[model samples]
Target: MDDEQQDGRAVRVERDTMGEVEVPADRYWGAQTQRSLEHFDIGRDTFVWGRPVVRGLGLLKKAAAQANHDLDLLPDEIADAVVQAADEVARGELDDHFPLVVFQTGSGTQSNMNTNEVVANRAVEILGGELGSKDPVHPNDHVNRSQSSNDTFPTAVHVAVALELAERLQPAVDGLVLALEAKAEEFADVVKVGRTHLQDATPVTLGQEVGAWSGQLREAWGDVRHAGDRVLQLAIGGTAVGTGLNAPADFGPTVARHLADETGLAFRQADNLFVQLAAHDGLVAVSSSLRTLAGGLMKLANDVRWLASGPRTGIGELRIPENEPGSSIMPGKVNPTQSEAMTMVVTRVFGNDATVGFAGTQGNFQLNVFTPVMAHGVLESIRLLADACRSFTEHCVVGLEADTVRIAEHLEDDLMLVTALAPHIGYDKAAAIAKQAHRDGSTLREAALASGDVTDEDYDRWVDPAAMTRPG
Candidate 1:
């Protein structure tokens, strides 16, 4: 019963120096990959390394095969097979084969070998050979030619992060900024009472307030873009310890050219692959920039939440579109759901950045043992922020409206309008007028006129809310 198991076809034996492993027969992965699966029985989360990293690794192998073929380092037939198989991986056709967790070996050697074995087996199949043959396409000797996990893993991180930022996050943030800019222009003339320390102080146009948020988002976008520049310098071709022992002198630049062509971004070899491979400061820089962007998003979301607080009892200066039922029990309640979602997403981004910062400093000597965790943190942050920006723009910012009537009503009867008179009249006189209005429950206009602090003509000219929003 145990000798020939059910169907006797589920798995086959694959051998490495450690021992033989029974790998699933249908899988594109081999011995080391099976060992990783058996050793790290961590979680069910399959996409821990994300799609971009997997795809970037595929691209790296594809480019390396071509470079090796061009330099006459590998045979043309085998190179063509490897290239075709790698392209399939890059297009996400082989995602199921990459099932390693994010909690693998610190150097990501297991993950890299997983990729190598998958690509090699698939290429072997394409060349009309049996799986795990190491025949026409060997995992390490052929598929992983002139590379090591130390260099390739970090290179894949940079490629994946940079491409995701330029393609997804940048466009989403651009949309948010444009939405806020349009709102600022639309609300330019709508004046409202301004507060400091949660108390009324002066008047300002609602456009100016919205414009401030737009400026913050633009600055955040700039920081992210600048950080991406650092991420474009890759650690590939460094091989074992940045010495490029097995790799040719031209391999790094040649692969960089291929990557630049494939991604449509200006990628280059790292100036010092030793430093890049040893330290994850490049990832930390990008994470820090994302943290700054998240901070800006938090401020903007809070402002929106406060501005659209209530229709009756709260500071209802703005109205957000009600996309869903606010509560299950409360029948007539509406909430700032989009702003709330954005704030929560920003909080997660902040946490992810902190994780990235901690992982970045975990480098010991020649290599960082924290690549998997660092990649997970930074990639998740980018993904969440991109989606959050799009959600905030579509659900909240685009459909927002100004409460012109409420704004005007608050601006007219406000005692803070006396601030205008403080310059024309003495401070003591203005204070007396304001105090009398407050005590007698009269409007500032009535108190000022009765007290004869300034003539009615001067009061009308100086206390204009629209004029107060600008310089004298």
Candidate 2:
């Protein structure tokens, strides 16, 4: 078995073209995978980056086997074995075998070879041979017959991102929108003082305010879907440098069709593999969409936090649901924890978007080297945003209650309510009334009455705040 005892441990000496290296007897990887493990120790991130890529690679290999078998390139038995092994990999039965980090190899060649070795070893074991044999189903000659890391890695990025947005992020965002709509309906009759530039402006129903947040989320969802459409175009058939070296002419299209069937997502070969492989524009677009969504979430969370500021002093027009005690020393203090968590997610997404943009630009000639980081950034944003949306929906939006008494108090006390008298009493009279209210430390209603600007009947008819809120 090429194994020897050294320091009471059995080590297998696996030889590649460079030389022989000692590998663990129990692992499925060969010399190259072993070398990567020793070489790239920059992060303790583990094989997390490889999960989606490996899953996509599994699907790619399965499709390639089918396509090659149909083309009479791969024999039926080996193709069947490879398909079974790849399916297991796709289902994440062998994630532990992929031990490389995200920071390894710019093209993710090590990760690709890592998948190849694992699939090949598993295929060999399925064929009644020992692991690491590279026997009936060799890693390159069989499993990776018509593929290159250049094409496969980028294709994996597309498959993982598109599937994640459709299956996870979209549903979470939809749930948030629905929750916001529910809140809007619940607070339909509650009127509050609107603010512009953090100064009192006029009057608005709480329903209108919450509905604006819902509209922002809807727009963000549309942007995510548009970006996802770009990722559905794969560079798989392009091979090493977009030249399809040693691959069949129809390999790309056939494999893409099989991938579409496997994923139930409309995956297509890129119109030009050169452009697709050379740049990560699709991922950058997705990150940009995520950044936009983050911005909307940040604004909404800040609005909620400010609206629910204090129980005694600040603008308490909305009561945020208290899930936990806010302070250790202070009594009866409840914070907008959900909003805080949501804003934190927003900040992380902003940083991730920046990282993706920078990584997208690191492409050289025919291959983007920053693929793993780009993939990690996109996936992280999707995962964090999905969780944040669901959490914010449940903890804050669903149980949020409008402080209607405080809202009415604020509306009655706001100086900007004099804006209602602008058309009827003239701007100069309205400005004088506002100045009198501020100078006399009186309410707008009290000062307007004292000014003798209009009769009580005229004031009642013209200064209807609710009527001011609607379209003229």
Candidate 3:
């Protein structure tokens, strides 16, 4: 493991007949990587242990290997081998072959190694041989020569989030937007009571209220799209502290271009190396925007669930699709489970945003060791919230119907219509009429007609719930 190079200073490298057989347990990386293996291993999980990170790391390695092609530093044979290995990774060829182990912790190095081995073996197979030979092109020296985990990890995280979000979240938000817009159009003709302070105050079309909700969702859609766009900014070239040391001069830009072409992403190099290496602010910022949208959805879902509460006993203006019986003892009972699920999903998104914010704050100086967990947390939130949004729209919002019978029954009271009479009759007379109608077991229409304040034609025209609830 000890050797004297040209300068006669003892290098603690372990080399054997096979090659540099010994790697530093703490930091095995050549001077290229910062804090290397020791810096990456934070936590581990079984299900999602290494798949995404390994495949992505391998892809990055192959992408960087091509940098030498543009820079004219590597031969054609090696470049072709690297490209082949990367193609395999991008095609998901090695996903099932490797069983993720404890080595694939949150630190990401072991996962990176897993990727290297898979790609290298795969490339070797292409060259007509067995695995683990490290031949033709080495995973470390050739494929991953110019990069460090410091830059590669952040780059891969952004790429994965951006790709997956585009494939999943954006479309889900669009679906919710379409659903809300449909409701707005559907309810445009239905007039309803507009409540203020939980008491009937004025008239408004139901469509107008639904239109407001649609507008909020439209804004939320914009917010989510913008957050996804922010993911396009990558931190790829900023090797070990963003100094670009040990990296080929033009390798960063060249490789970034290659990757963009390969992945169909708009990845760009970090403008500020120091900030890119030291902060996780971009992820935090994007997640905060997602949280805002989730908050809006939670509020909207709660409102809809309350509005669709009951057909027989409550203000049943809306009816959601029934998936199952809501109560065991009660017959024909169904709960707004879709809305409830949406509420819970939004809550998780909020919690994930909080995690991202907190993790961003914890990145002290040169790097964020919590990136693996932080990225996973936000991605899971996005995936869950997006799925929940789609489910809520399909199962709940689309099928909801206004309860005209309940509307008519509630309209029969007409006690709320006494407020409209206040302008014609004095406020005191209106209150007295309302109180007498409440006590004397007569409708406000009968009390008013008896008191000679209004006629039948006026009662029908003026006291109708449809007319009373229309927006001014």
lDDT of each: 0.88, 0.87, 0.69
Q: Please report the candidate that would top lDDT against the real structure.
A: 1
Please give, for residues 333-423, the per-residue lDDT of candidate 3 as tens digits. Answer: 8988888888888878888887889878876677777776677766777778789988987888788787766655665664777877777
Question: Model 1: which ten-residue window has the lowest total lDDT?
Answer: 1-10
TM-score of model 3 (CA atoms): 0.81
Where does candidate 1 stray beyond 4 Å?
A: 1-9
Q: Give the alpha carbon lDDT tens digit for every residue of 72-115 in model 2.
A: 89998999999999898888887777788888988889888887
* Native-to-model Cα distance after best TM-score fit, residue 332 in candidate 3, in Å: 4.0
What's the C-alpha lDDT at position 346 in model 3?
84
Q: Find the candidate with the highest TM-score and give its number.
A: 2
Better by TM-score, candidate 2 or 1: 2
| Best of the two (1, 3) by TM-score | 1
The weakest ten consecutive residues by lDDT in model 3 span 26-35
Let me know the TM-score candidate 2 reaches against the reference structure: 0.97
